[model samples]
Each structure stands twice: as structure tokens, then as C-alpha cells.
Target: MNNIEFIRNEEKKYHDFCYENYKLFEEGSWLYKPVKTVMDLLPLFDNNESLNVIDLGCGVGRNSIPIAEAIKNKNGKVVCVDLLDSALNKLKEYSKQYKVEKVIRTEKADIGNYKIKPNEFDFIIAVSALEHVKSEEVFEEVVRQMPEGTKNNGVNCLIINSEVQEIDLETNEKLDVLMELNLSIEVMMNKLSSIYTGWEVLKTVVNPLEYNITRSEKPVLLKTNAITYVVRKSIG
Candidate 1:
């Protein structure tokens, strides 16, 4: 299998396994580990407020289901988008089982192709999603689509533990977004401290959105290289 085909197949295998043993992970120690780590890296969220969320590259609905439950009580919704049919089906099932069907919306689209409303999301999240997308253009396009903030100031945050290389297709330029840099809660909080202050704080804290690095010049890689970025949107 080629790169694209290989990724598709690997995704299939993953879904097949997750669908069968999802219960083992759901609310279990095995499941919420990464989630806890990710949440720790985030700013505070209110329990009684409503917000909008988009789960890009939602695979097998594992993260989607929990996200739905976490946000439902807050009157928030999670739009789960993915390219694979199997993953969507599983998300639907989980939503129904968890009684979050009303809170979760599933979409069948190559995440890299859609135009997202910039700064529109109260929260934008991805779970190990970016590394698999095939095209840098498609990936960057998604970022450009995030709609500028229309309501209260919002932000976008994404974290991924993998290799990252920023390559410009138009100019063939390259930059390093992050390297073996896991955007942990500690790092994120520190960055925000420098950015936020009394009366200057915003409603959302999702910025410096985390997308996947599509290229590489080196062979050495680290597993803890997840990066988290926060970009805030201001309500004009």
C-alpha cells in the first residue's frame, strides 16, 4: 500500500479494534489518560455555559463521545468530522448510546478540504488527526477557513504528539512549528500567562491551532513531540 492507501488501511484496522472494545476505554483508565493530559493543558471552562466545538478527524468516536458528554451539560455541541465511513458510523452509535445524539453532529468530509469558520469555535480540537492527512495545501486551507470571531472572543487549540515540519508549497519555504515539543498543560499555561492579564483576558483561549507537520528533513523523531497552540478571536 502506498502512503495514502496505507493510512486508510491503518485507520480501518484501528476503527475495527476500537469498535469492538470501546467499552474498555470509555471512562476507563485506559481511555481518559491522554484526554486528561490534554485537558490539563487547557484553560478553564465554565460548567454552566454553552459553547461550540469542532472535532476534526474524529476517529472511531472515542474522543467524540466523551467530548459530547463533557460539553452537553454545558449546552455545547461537538461537530465530529472525518473522512472514513466506519468512523462516522461508530460515532453515531456512541452518540445514541450516550444519549448525546442531539449534541454530536457527524460529517463525511476529508477534513483537509472543508472551509472552517475562523475564530467561530469556542473550542476546536483534533485527536492524533493531523499527522495522517496527505496534502499540505488541504491542511493549510482548513486553517484559513476558521472564520474570524463573530461573537465573544474565541480561540483554537490543537495538540498532537508527532513529527512536525512546516513547508510552504507556494514559496517552498520551511519553518518548524514544534519539534518533540508536547504542548502540555504546563507549557500552554505559561504561554497564556504572558499573553493574558487583568481585564485583558478573552472569552476563548483557542489559538495557535495545532495542525500536522506534513514534511521532514530528518529521520530522528520523538513520541512525545505533541504541540499545542492557542489563537484567540476577538468579538468586534
Candidate 2:
């Protein structure tokens, strides 16, 4: 299949999986926690000033809710973008419970098709997002648009899957995975450096993790390499 088609299939599969197991996105579930990487960088945002933020693939307001709460007093707003309506609906419910519903807006759009407007946001985060763009061209275009999308001195945090091995649950054998990036840490950093030359790199980390999942009544382990980057646009 072609890149766009591959992405569509992967998205459908993921949506179905999440729909079948929607409870995992409930308020108290493990996946509902704010990402530590994002939490760590929260202090950098100026609480006194209104900030425009975007959370790509903001699953169930895990990070977006807290962010909205933080910036609510400042009249800051967070635009949440995700491919699944179910996820966005859950996020809306959580936002209301958190009392930050006014500060949060949800949009359903695939990352590959979403357009990032120039100088649009003061803060942008994509936790475990962007890696789903199966098309290298699409990924490059997104990266290219980031610098312009961010206002001067704006901050951005991205946590992406750099490498991962998918295993068949029934046989516990490695599957021929076609959906994710498999770049080494160095290569990934180099690519980011090339794309984000207008930004100052504040942090770069590569985390090695083993994720266990059950499929077909068998346990499958995924050796995952996750990369986190915190960058700020250079002052013009």
C-alpha cells in the first residue's frame, strides 16, 4: 500500500483498538496521566501571559487538561487535535470535570492533513504523536512547518517513537511492522537538528522501554525506543 493508504489503515486499526478498550482512556487509567516530559517543561510557560497551545494527538486530555488548568487564569487556550472522535469526546468530558472546559477546544483531524498556521501558537506539544505519519514526505513537511507555526521564542515539546519492534501475540514472534519509524537516536537527532534549525534545543533524550501487551490471548513484548525533544524558537 502507499504511504497515505498505510497511514489510513494504521489509523483505523488504532481507532478500533482504542474503541474496543475505551476504558483505558478513562480519567483514572494509566494512559490518562500527563506525560512527565511535558510536565517537566510546563514551568517554562509564562503564567502571567496568555498562551496559545496545541496538543496533537491529545488522547483524552491526559496532558491537555492540566495544561489548560495551568493557563486558565491567564486566559490561555489549548487546541486539541486528534484523529478519533471518541478520544476527543472523552477529552471534552475530562475537561469539564477539571473545570477547564472554556480553555480547551477540540478538533478532529489527522496530523498528516492538519495545517499548522504561521506564528499561530506560543506553545505546541505532540506527545507520542507524529510518528504515526507513515509518509516520509508528510513527516518532512510537518517538520518544515513547525518553525513557522510557532511564534518567536515559543516552546515545543515532542515525544515520538523512534524505534519499535512489533510481535505477534499468538506466536510471540516478531511481526513485519510497516507503520513506525526505526531511526537510531543519533540519526533522529540529526534529522531534527536539520529541520529545527531556527530553534534552540533545550533537551534531547532517548528512552529504551519494553512494553507488554496481550493480543490473541498471548503476551507480546515490544522493544520500544522513544525520543523526547524540548525546543524553543530563536528570538528574531
Candidate 3:
């Protein structure tokens, strides 16, 4: 199929899967908890009286919920954006359940097409989200906008999956990976390094991961290199 068709199919798959998974923060699941790295960085903005944060493609407030709790007392707001309505609906429920409803605002939009205002946010996070953009060009443009939208001394934390491969466990046959912008490890690193030039690289890590997952009722072995790159925008 063509790129657009593939992307549409992928979106539907995710939408259905998200709707089926009613619980967030469930034990032993991929969404078991928020990323520790994201939580660790929240203390850096403790002194700010009012904080503005953006979470691109935030799935059911996995990271957004904790961030809202951290900044609730300081008039902090976490703008949670996702393409799926079900995810956002669940996030709203969780926000109310956690008593931080006032701190979160939800927006439904494709991350690639979402516009971020310049120098507006103290923290911008896109976890396991960038790789789903429509293409590598869109990925670069979004990355370009991320730092531009971040205020000086602000942070941008991105967790992207690269070099994804899937194999049918039952037949040991290779299957087409559904990612929209599945760049090679080398290309992905180069793009980040070039775009984030002069920024303070607080953390840079690449973890090779292989896991078993069920997709379309078939067991599959998914292999990917998960890259975490966190940087602070430098002030002139």
C-alpha cells in the first residue's frame, strides 16, 4: 500500500487497541508507568511559579498525569496532545480521578501537523511519538519546531524508536513494520545531532530492545532501538 494508506491503517489499529485497553498504569503492560527519565526532570522547574508543558502524542496521560501533579500547586499546565479520541477521553478520566483536572488541557491533533508557538513552553516531551509522523521530512520539521517552541533553559525530551523490525513468531517470517518514519539508527542520530546543535545534551542513550507482542491476533517479535535524547535549550 501507499504511505498514506499505510498510515491510516496503522492509526485505526492503534485506535482500536487503545479502546480495548481500558486501564492505564496496569502492571507488566507497556503502559505500566511513566518513564522514569521524564519524572526525574520535573524537579528542575520547581522554582518556576507557573509552568507550561506540552506532551506530543501523549497516550492517556502516562507522563502527563504525574507532570500535572507536580505542577498543580504552581499554576502549572500540561497540554496533552494525541490523535486518538479514546486516549484523550481516558486521559480526562484519569486526570479527574487523580484530582488534577484543572492542570491538564487536551488537544486532538496529529503531532506532525500540530503547531507549537515559539519560546512558549518550559518542557516539551514526545515519547514514542515522533517515529509515527507521516515521513522523515515531517519528523525533521517537528523536531525543528520543538526547540524553537522551548524557552531558554527549557527542556525537550524525546523517546523515538528506530530500526524497527517485526517477525512472525509462529513462522519465523519477517513482516513489514508499521512505523511511518522508520529511519536507520545512523540517520536518526545524525538528524538529531544536526538539529539540536549547541544545545546541552543532558542525556543521550540508545537501548536495543526486543520484545514479544501480539498484533492482529498473531504473536510477533518486535525489535527496535529506542533512543532517548534530552537537551536544554541554550540562552544566548
Q: Which residue ranges in model 1 land beyond 4 Å of their true spot?
A: 22-34, 37-43, 47-49, 147-152, 164-224
Clashes of each: 16, 0, 0
Point out the worst 10-residue segment of candidate 3 by lDDT.
14-23
lDDT of 2 by residue, 17-134 (tens): 6545755335533464678878777787765477899998887787898889888988799999998877888788878888999999999998878898899998899987787775
| TM-score, every prediction | 0.63, 0.87, 0.95
For all candidates in order, the CA lDDT equals: 0.57, 0.78, 0.90
Compute the lDDT for candidate 3: 0.90
lDDT of 1 by residue, 91-172 (tens): 7876888799999988898777656664556767666665555654444445545434223555555554444445555455
Q: What order do you get sorting by lDDT, best first? A: 3, 2, 1
Give per-residue CA lDDT, model 3, range 1-236, as digits (tens): 98777766765675558546646787755677899999999988988988999999998888999899989999889999998877898899999999999999999999999999999999999998999888889999999999999998999999999999999999999998877888888899999999999999999999999977767878889899999999999897
25: Cα error in model 2, Å? 7.8
Provide the clash count, candidate 2: 0
Clashing pairs in 3: none
RMSD of 3: 1.4
- Identify the leading candidate in terms of TM-score: 3
Return the clash pairs for model 2, or none.
none
